[model samples]
Target chain A: MAETPIRFGILGCAHIAQTVSRAICLSPNSTLYAVGSRSFEKAKKFSEANGFPPSAKIYGSYEALLDDPDVDVVYVPLPTSLHLRWVVLAAEKKKHVLLEKPVALNVAELDEMIKACEVNGVQFMDGTMWMHHPRTTKMEEIIYDPERFGNIKTVHSIFSYGGGDDFLRNNIRVKPDLDGLGALGDAGWYCIRAILWAAEYELPKTVTALREPVLNEAGVILACGSSLQWEDGKTATFHCSFLANLAMDITVLGTTGTLHVHDFVIPHEENTASFLAAAKTGYWELVTGMSAIPSQHVITTDLPQEVYMVTEFSRLVKSIKDGGSKPEGKWPSISRKTQLVVDAVKASIENGFEPVQVRV
Target chain B: MAETPIRFGILGCAHIAQTVSRAICLSPNSTLYAVGSRSFEKAKKFSEANGFPPSAKIYGSYEALLDDPDVDVVYVPLPTSLHLRWVVLAAEKKKHVLLEKPVALNVAELDEMIKACEVNGVQFMDGTMWMHHPRTTKMEEIIYDPERFGNIKTVHSIFSYGGGDDFLRNNIRVKPDLDGLGALGDAGWYCIRAILWAAEYELPKTVTALREPVLNEAGVILACGSSLQWEDGKTATFHCSFLANLAMDITVLGTTGTLHVHDFVIPHEENTASFLAAAKTGYWELVTGMSAIPSQHVITTDLPQEVYMVTEFSRLVKSIKDGGSKPEGKWPSISRKTQLVVDAVKASIENGFEPVQVRV
Candidate 1:
């Protein structure tokens, strides 16, 4: 017997929507059932340009797409400022929500969306695609093994891309009404998540923003960095910028080992990724060289990470719709934790770079 | 006929002295002429174990070794506390000085040593061996290329080694009266140098030590980190610890290029080293992957970095002794700058983690 694929309806034709639309088509347990935009012409064009099935529906308004009874899930790729409204409405319509990152303008708004999803009994997961990659899983296996990695003492992450002068002046990300957080919300989201993920999702005791964050005239952060410290002496630092060249890095140092990955947010290749790990590393005789070098581990996947994310989200949606199971709490919990740290960092920046306690 | 090699005298027989002794023997322009310790038997044993030539002299006391008119240079491997006394004495005796890192207890002490060397017309070079590596020069060339690397934005460096329980309890680095700066002086020195090297030796405007520094009972810093901010908005962060695995890394992010070197302090292979550089990197279509991966550049050398250090120092010494040229000021200037930053970080930590202005 074959299980029916979950039907997906995408809200807004944002640039990222095109990628998620393709992911829905590629995921084995999901189908791109519909797409919605402000105008019928735009929706129709998106549907035709992407490989949407001929039977897929196109709606002129997001409301019409959410009203469709056949849509079991809605992937929201709207700007961050619109997330609270669209995500809550989709949950009210009993549609599983796969929201893009920088989940909301702040944690308070995200809490409303999460509450709506819980009350409606629909799964909710953010669109952090790299979390589903097989390479992330492989690295996790080594880091989690005490004998292999020991206790993680510190971490450093960087995610930055050189957005041209035009982007600095005109990109939606730099606009206050759009993605407002700018570099901190876009590129920095990945770095923050990387640090928290390296810490096994443990929230830090305090967050302190570093000095000299570059800001646009509209007061959106163009570049910034922060340090996180835990009560048990664990610490981490991260940098994110829209002014530097494309660089995605994560370095985790443990009591007896270290892990390094240069392309943590997006792999350089679609189907393959690699990470370096060293356990019990030491120096050679006379301290002239390393006793053993870090070994590189390559992970291969049949599908891109976005598709894996879609497949996983759909699998959870199927259990709720067909098997009468409850929504998984892990995804939403992780999202809220990341947002909490994000909020703390912003508060520290606003508070004159003082250390801000991370509240629950 | 080949010009006469610079005759070298070593003070103390610390473990590092063995490595530097080997380097002196290997360098073409340096010769292991004499060694000294508190006891003549220990000096004789060290000379025999370190492959000194048959004509090598052994002295019961450091003062005796420094008094030898034939010894053109003295390599001081004594503890930080003894550096001021021994280095000043060596300089006054007309011997060029190759002082081990953490050159002095503080900038003031370092200034005294430098002044002594300057007044006596003797070369002064700190034994930061990696600075002499060919790989270091290759990395510098790339980072300094404005067309390729653009403006430097941020840097992160880490140098850590897990010293085990016994080392944590008994090592001289953890003893306040000996290497009082502990990991900051030993491992952190390299990280600071790396950050400065990335910035082309521009001093930061201020420094703020991160919270939760691990300190020994004697108040020696075992693990710590700091964030440095430049007047022009450039920033750098570094971490050094005796509690983590052996990890030496330097990541430099620029406006148009990125540089990463995992084994910046000590190469994995003595004969070869490598670093990754990416210029004009961007995302692929749909933001699925990178447009181009970073290129790996491998630099090979015929001599070990420590040997190169000895050769370079000896070259300067020979130039002063034989060519009638004054000692090069570049080496002392760099060493002083590095010490100044080290002093600032320590001051920041002592001052309740507040930002401390870096006074030149």
Candidate 2:
């Protein structure tokens, strides 16, 4: 019997949808089945521009696309303000969700989205592409090695990119209504997730926002940082900004090992990823030099990270449909944990940079 | 017609003195003239093991080394508690002082040391070797380049090393009476200095110690971190530990550039040092990847860093002796500022992790 590919429906013709649209076409387990935008012309243009197959359908309204029985999964790339409406509607229509982040404006909205997916018995996942990359798993192996890595001590992550004059002036991310969380939601989301991931999904006990985050005239965060403390004395710090040069990095320190990756959010190449690792390193006589230099580990993948993300989401959807497996709760749980930390950081920032307890 | 080398006296036979003694010999304008310890036989063994010249004088006590008029400069590598008494004696005896890090227990003690050097008209410089390396000047070029580096936004540094079970129990760094600041003084001194160096020696406005710094049973810091914020919105964070792998790194992020060095405290190699630098970087279209990778800049130094440090100290001493120039105040000032920030961080930790305003 031929294996059936999960069909994808994309809501909105967002700029991110262009990349994910290509990913949908590239993923072996998923098909670019339908696209919906307020203007049918925009959906058609997006499909044609991004190599959508001729069999792919287009609709003027998201409702039409979600109503299609063939859209086994919906990838919603709508603005934060519109997520609650469209994501809940997609769930009610019995479609699995592969949602783009923020995930929502706050935890309350995210809870609703998760609840809707739960009630509909559909898989839910955030569009955090890096998590699905093979290199991540490879790095995880090094981090968890007891003899080499030992117990975790500290982790630091950053995701900052230069936004030109035009972006600072005109981008929706700089506006309060469209993407209200600003850099905290856009770039900081990845930094928080990376810290949480390095800590093995253990939520931090406290989150304190670093002082004086840069904000736009509309009060949207342009740059911010936070320090998180765990119950076990492990510590993590993260920074995110749209004002600095493009830099995405994570440094994980353990009792005996240290790991560094310069591009964790987006690999420099489509096929290969690299990270620097050092285990049991010591200084030379007189502390003039290191006993051994850190070695770089490169990982090659058959598929790009975006495609990998789509494939993973599709695989989860297929498990429920064909394998009689329940919807995977891990994905939504990760997203929720990430959102809860984000809320704590934002709260810390709002509350005069006081350390806020992470309640989740 | 010939330049006279700065004569040197060793104040104690500490482990670090073995390295600095060799550096004094290697430095062109310095001579290691005297060695001293309470146990004359121990001092004699150290001098023999570390290749002290046959002409070098050995003394039964540190006061004998300081009292020797031929000893133009005294290099003090004693534990923190002994620094005030011995260094003050050396300075008062009209000998220039080249002291080890954690120059004193606090800023107040550091001020006394600095004042002794000032009143006695003797050059005062702490033995922070990396600052005098040629590679430091080369990296400084990139950091100060407005076209490339722009305004510094953030600086993150770490200097951590592991201690074996026996060393953890016995090393001076872990002992409250011997080196009261523990890791905060040993490793954190370099971390704080790196932050200050990257910030062009400007003291931060506030220092907030990160929560839950690991302390030993003797109430000495084993691992700790702190965040500093400057008035100009630039921020920095550093972590120092005796409980983690050997990792000395500095990550400086600017508006238009980023600089990364895995070995800021001590390079992985002796003669060659490298740093990763990227200027005006951006993401590739659709955020698929970075437009350019950070290039590695290798700097070759003919002299080792410790040798450079010694040569610089000797040159300052020579300028005062030969050219009748006043002692340079820059080095002592840098030490004072570093100690001030260190005091603030320690105060914050002791005061239940409150944000402490840097008095400087």
DockQ of every predicted complex: 0.89, 0.78
> What is candidate 1's TM-score against the reference?
0.99
Return the TM-score for each candidate structure.
0.99, 0.98
Task: State residue A325's C-alpha deviation in candidate 2, in Å.
Answer: 1.3
- Cα displacement (angstroms), candidate 1, residue A1, comes to 4.5
* Residue range A1-360, candidate 1, lDDT tens digits: 878999999898888888888898999999999999999999999999989999999999999999999999999988899999999999999999999999988999999999999999999999999999989999999887888889999999999999999989888889999998889889889999999999999999999999889998889999999999998899999999999999999999999889999999989988899999999988888988887589999998888899999999999999888889999999999999999988988999999999999998
How many Å off is the CA of B69 in candidate 1? 0.4
Stretches of candidate 2 off by over 4 Å are none
lDDT of 2 by residue, A28-92 (tens): 88888899999999999988898888989999999999999999999998888788888899999
Name the DockQ score for candidate 2.
0.78
lDDT of 2 by residue, B294-354 (tens): 9999999776799999988898898898889999989999999999998999999999888
Give every collision pair in model 2. Answer: none
Local distance difference test, candidate 2: 0.91
lDDT of residue A110 for candidate 1: 95
